[model samples]
Target chain A: MKGPRLTEIVAGLPAIVPFVGPETQERQRGRPFRARLGANENVFGPSPAAVEAMARAARDAWMYGDPECHDLRAAIASQHGVAPENVLVGEGIDGILGLAVRLVVAPGDPVVTSLGGYPTLNYHVAGHGGRLVQVPYRDDHEDPEALVAAAWEHGARLVYLANPDNPMGTWHDAATIGRMIAELPEDVLFLLDEAYVEFAPAGAVPAIDISDPRVLRLRTFSKAHGMAGARIGYALGAADVIAAFDRIRNHFGVSRIAQAGALAALGDRASLDRVVKEVAAARDAIARIARQNGLTPVPSATNFVAIDCGGDGDFARRVLAELIARDIFVRMPSVAPLDRCIRISCGRAEDLELLARALPDALAAARA
Target chain B: MKGPRLTEIVAGLPAIVPFVGPETQERQRGRPFRARLGANENVFGPSPAAVEAMARAARDAWMYGDPECHDLRAAIASQHGVAPENVLVGEGIDGILGLAVRLVVAPGDPVVTSLGGYPTLNYHVAGHGGRLVQVPYRDDHEDPEALVAAAWEHGARLVYLANPDNPMGTWHDAATIGRMIAELPEDVLFLLDEAYVEFAPAGAVPAIDISDPRVLRLRTFSKAHGMAGARIGYALGAADVIAAFDRIRNHFGVSRIAQAGALAALGDRASLDRVVKEVAAARDAIARIARQNGLTPVPSATNFVAIDCGGDGDFARRVLAELIARDIFVRMPSVAPLDRCIRISCGRAEDLELLARALPDALAAARA
Candidate 1:
């Protein structure tokens, strides 16, 4: 029954997935949900061109993708007016976060993130045997100042922040973020997850120099470009830091179809603009729905709204369970206080209608 | 200008990709190859059903794929006659190899593989700081007996063998492999890579015994299933060994579109059978062409044929270069003795015609 012993780090780790898929829940419930508004997926879908490109590339799936992600990186570079060396395209921001943690965090190394920020990042830190030092959120936003102070206090090797943050969907202005960047220890690497950046206001992303070497900015096709299923994302950083990925990454990990789809998605800025607008409108609709249900929806810069249920985590959990029971799929935060809010993604009008129908009943059921 | 220092292991490793992709080569040469018979890609492509499935899934690209890969695993398990709990699908066999190496190899741990076996596996071992103890191929095939000896001699944590191996298109029969497995150290994990198993002869795959904790079998949709670009592969092992992946894997790494395409691919056995027949014919055609050119084609048990170029490694390299120059993309091994052969994949009839026309000139160029 015994096999080769796993590395001490791996053996000590727990078998855990950061989030459970709605499909798994559906299987247990024995019925599919009418509204798929959880996971913050783009209900509007990817650009027509991207879809066509992936379809065409499907036949060529026999060939492995370019290990270097040449075409996609070239397109991203041209779009951002940076050298191709500045980018490292990976499976997704999630995958890149794992790789980044592997590169910098050795056993017992200190890493920092806001409490209840992104569990996946924390998951990676734990996987690598790093010691996680959490800075709690300020007003439901990742407190930049607290994170920097903790980095110095802990002599942390890495610090993570998600701009236009998930769960709470709050954001910090570019100037504030830049000042936070200025105060950070030069030895502490910053992971600026711009996963929701495209949906944020124009001035939200700091104009930091890529040559600074202290920061890695992660951008994904999952959000604005609506290619989450393609699993394509890139990190922008100093050339040396970027090149470090070549040493350890599964070189041919990115599939050929994903490369083609992401490249096409990057080229179609018009479609991205349209998605941003649609997401904004959907966010507004969700906020209104929350108000109608006697809950307060936190104003969102991202594609999802977090509705405070004005009670404990258990009440929010009940509301979420009731929503699911009524064929509406929604998620909530895992940690306390934040867990008092239920998270709903922006969806199509019909999907929102299903949510509207379910919300009041779910709230009443939870109250009962 | 400083960032967090990479861990001593990562900092000491070279920032290099094991293989330069064909696209990168094409970019460097400023022209695309006319016949891409390199990389052992299925030139005939995937099933129409799979293509259609991916096209349909493209519209749903906004959602993250089920992190568990539920449907695909169910389909694969049913096809393979194993429980879904015994299966662990990954980005590709390449990705799974990386994870396996990471699980077992700590700093300075010894691992064993053929001297010239899959470089990507070796790359993963080195990335995780595993000391690679290579046993050279005996004759043209990987010598399983030698590998077992190496494992015991080094007290290696893991041993890797590719049945119906890559680069050479050679194989060791199941009985031979099973006999060697019996002799392996009880505690040494065995990575049995069955990437080309579908193209292998009947009974080539050892009998499935999920209770054997020492062995993990890796199967890929990339090869025979023609979904390489979709990046789906699975590993089968004892429940405990299989479950270890959840401790460290990027949960949402696989794409929703990929999962859909792979599920469709698995359901269509007729398509797989057809591709197998085509692959056999293509292998025969390659062997015939090699004979006509006064070369010896190594006996193959896989989709590709390795043609002995009747010269040294340098001559084979020159021949490969000439074939690439003539737009008939082909590759050769990196090590001695094995490098005396040029590897060519099974392609469409038109592609073979191009190869036929180009081989003589390429041979002459190599001789010169």
Candidate 2:
């Protein structure tokens, strides 16, 4: 029988997964990692209140979640000092990115981003048949000027930048990003991914300007709120742009447990502050470990630190493999230059202790 | 400033939401409903084991869920006697349907469905710019022959049917549906939504045939498994067809709690059977109430029943409005003939008792 014919766009696209979860590796290795320090997940965990809310909501799982996500959006808006209409809650920033791309990008449209930035955004671009124009990083930081130049040159529909960038753990301060946004073509949408903003210093984040129709800022409970597994995130943008999400998004996509958990997570300021502090300490510990091993650690504003392996991408991969062999979970960037470093998420004390023990042996094995 | 330019397709698309959630109505009305039955959620609730699993997983919300959904898919496959590759887990049936439409329906592509069928599927097709060719339901049941005929007539890329249909709660036996499937065009992908299948009779569901490349059967934790708020569902299809989901789906869309909960729900057959029994009893009770109010209840295989209001669509609308004013949340079909009935989900005894009391007054209000 002739099967269903895939659309030209889908049929021509490569079967690519942006990131492989740590669980896949655990299954393949036939053992669990001693330290789960990959994926940049806040190992300090979600607020007690959030967990409590989720547990309580579980019994009510028989009801479909509010398709409008009214309360969650309202809470997010109030916190951000915006109207509820300005916020759109989704499964995560990843899901929201997909919808944003769908809203603006057509087949063959150009989308600009850092060369080795968040691959999930790139994956969404590819899925929608958008052409990517990648700007190489400058000194391990996403080059805002270069990205803006590319967006202008390509007449890009969407331009994405992760503040306090991933993998390299490098960031540009608010003024640089704000200037970049101003330089972009008026028609080009700027996606400001603040997934790590809560962990960054005050100067690192730009003040919210809801009046900018071309800019959409995405934040998530997945980071400092320590609720990555809950799969909830929100985008703050112009009301018109935010409302566009309802036109195409799966309305009931966000789970009821997630809505309740995120609302509670937002209300619990103590937990957020505590997780941020723990992450800061873990980052320092990771850097110290890197220095002891004769490696350089990138100054990070995010929860994860990138430790230069003092070698090339190949050598870093070897070190990563050796760490995996020793039941340590870690990751590295995929592009050149930055790929010389291995990225490790902030872990709990025991998790970092395991990493501390494994690093030297893994480095030795890689060198050998 | 021009701001971001939406794609021509998106710009041209209508701002249509498939369903207005009950939460939205509650907010507008300034009160909560006495009985929550509007969305066809299983009010008897999810399995206790499933709830327990979700609550336990709540603490682990720090980590991202498995993108491959290996364990859950393996379990689903094992139950259905198919390879793990044949099962694709997603956020929900609504989410999976969106991906399916994206895979097959390009701009201006034809899609076929019952006139008043699951509007969410229509929403997705519209979102993708697919041309919908809706065939009218015959005698309140989805006319399988007309749908198949429409596929042939329009050369449809996709065809959708909900077994034990929603809104009307009518169903076709396995043999009839199997024959309908056989008559479909070789290249037209068939989306058989058996969301409420657990409540269906023995012959209502066709035998699983995962080898069929064109048929993708959808099942959910939302109905008989009673985990609607968890937002987890699975699609069973040919391995190649199922694997195509990876090309465009939000890989991490499903929540970690939902995966664990659904896995536990699948394991707890006793709980599932018990829910089914309760649903059957509730269906009977709802039917008895309808009869007592001088209404004709449609024979239903799903967890909800559609009662003929003995009036036209306008009268049914008035009755629905009166019910809503009484703080009893219920919905009716949107298309004619079917719209002459009001749909009510099976609920707990107290919920039904409340509905029973409200019906006569609602009907009188409509009559007056």
Candidate 3:
């Protein structure tokens, strides 16, 4: 029997999820993880106010959400000091990345990103049939200069960079990013993913310039605001670029509960600050744990830490596997050199305690 | 500055929202509608258990939902007596529609749909650069035969049919749809949108046959389950067709709360039956109200009724405006013939009473 014909791009693409969720892992293992410190989810949870708002909004789930995301966009604009027209709210950073790719990267187009950077971003690029030009990381950090150079070399349509980078948890200062932006080709759209920017230190976040159409800044409530399950994120860009999303985006894709929860979460600055503080403390504790276990921890600006396992990629793999077997979930970077480190998200003290308890045994097993 | 370059398809299309949400209207009017009978939302609300499940899930919103939607898909599969591979849950029907369009529609591909059918479906077609061949409705129902003819005429890649049709609140029986499916070309995909099928008359829905590779049946919790704001929907089809969705779908786009709510909603058969009954009563009340206002009510097997205002599209539009002015939210079809009718969703008795009180004045104002 003949099947539905997929687009040439999609037909050629392999079916794979960028990251398997911990739930899937739990289901496979037939047991839940002791410490869910893998996905970089804010284990601190959303603000009590946001939780209350979402719970309350649950009763009103009969009504579809505002398609334009007006109020939430307005609030986000007010917070970011940009016009509402410059902001586009979507399902999540993942969803926004897909839209951004669709907007610019047609089939056979060239796109640039760090090697072993965000897999989901690459997934969107490949899903759109974009030929990806990968720039190897410099000292485990996304090398901005090399990215721009590759974009120019490849005549890339888009360049993706995650500030306070994922997996490595390293960051470039605002001035450094500004310099990179200045050096980029005018025609190449820069997708600046700042999903973990909430945990970045002061001066790490670049100033928002809505006039520059070349840059799209992505922010999500999933990290610092702790609403990952809500699947709400926003992109800040030039008015026209933001407006172009309406041509293709699912208008009501952002749910009422998500909007309400994100709005409430954004308003709760005290909760955000508290979570940041908690994340910082947890990061330090994770670093201390690494040191105590004879591993070196990478300095991090984000909520997660990458610990050098003092071994090769295969050893790191074994460590990861042993951790998973111990019911302690953690992920490591993909590819050589970088894959020698395991990434751990900030967790509550009890969660960290479980991780700390598992590390020695896991490391010993890897050594075996 | 050079802006982000859009895909040729997106660049050519105007940035227009398919539907102007009621919230947008509320913002413009600076007042909330007393009766919201537009959008075909179920005013009976979600099952209490579903609401409770969502409310409870809200607290755990820090972690992303399972990317594979494992448990929910299993539940849906068992409920439909299909394999989990046959079900693909997404953000909503809107989201699933977008993915479906992306899956099969390459630039310049031909697509067939009823004129004045779901605008969002047309929007997706346009977004994907699909050439839409619209078949005019026969009587008030979407002409299955005409659609198939048009598909053959245009060499269409996909044909869209909304069973228990929107706006006009019309439908065809199972046999007619089965015949339509049988007539479709082997190369053409059939996108059967059953968003309103839960409220469709008994025997109106065709039996699920996952063996049919060309047909995809879309279902949603947004209608009879009263979880529109949750933005959760699923598509059932041949395992391969369903699997193709993962090639481009935002894996974690379905929220945790949405999964919990939908799972719980599906389990509460008593609540669903109650909602279907209440909606039938509401439909009758709406028809009575239309008759009281000297208008004709179209026969409906869905949650909404289409009231023919004894006028043309222009007059119907004016009546719609007057209803808006009277704090009643109702919608009308976009094209001729169907445009002569104003569609009202099933609402509670009080909301219908408001509609009853407002209709006469709205009609008179339009006449003036």
Q: Name every residue pair that clashes in candidate 3.
A: none
DockQ of each: 0.79, 0.83, 0.83
Predicted complex 2: CAPRI docking category: high
| lDDT over C-alpha atoms for residue B75 of model 2 | 98
Better of 1 and 3 by lDDT: 3
Question: On a 0 to 100 scale, what is the lDDT of residue B277 in model 3?
Answer: 94
- Give lDDT: candidate 2, residue B88: 95
Reference-based lDDT, residue B217, model 2: 99
- Report how far off residue A35 is in candidate 3 (Å): 1.1
Point out where model 3 deviates above 4 Å.
A16-18
| lDDT by residue (tens digit), candidate 3, A29-55 | 999998999999999999999999999
State the TM-score for model 1: 0.98
- Give the alpha carbon lDDT tens digit for every residue of A1-368 in model 1: 56878999998997655568889999989999899988988988999999999988887788898888887898898888889999999999999999999999999999999888888999999988999998888888889999999999999999999998988999999999999899999987899999999999988989858887889999999988899888999999999899988988888899788899999988888998999999999999999999998899998899999999999999999999999999999998888879899999999999999999889999999999
Candidate 3: DockQ?
A: 0.83
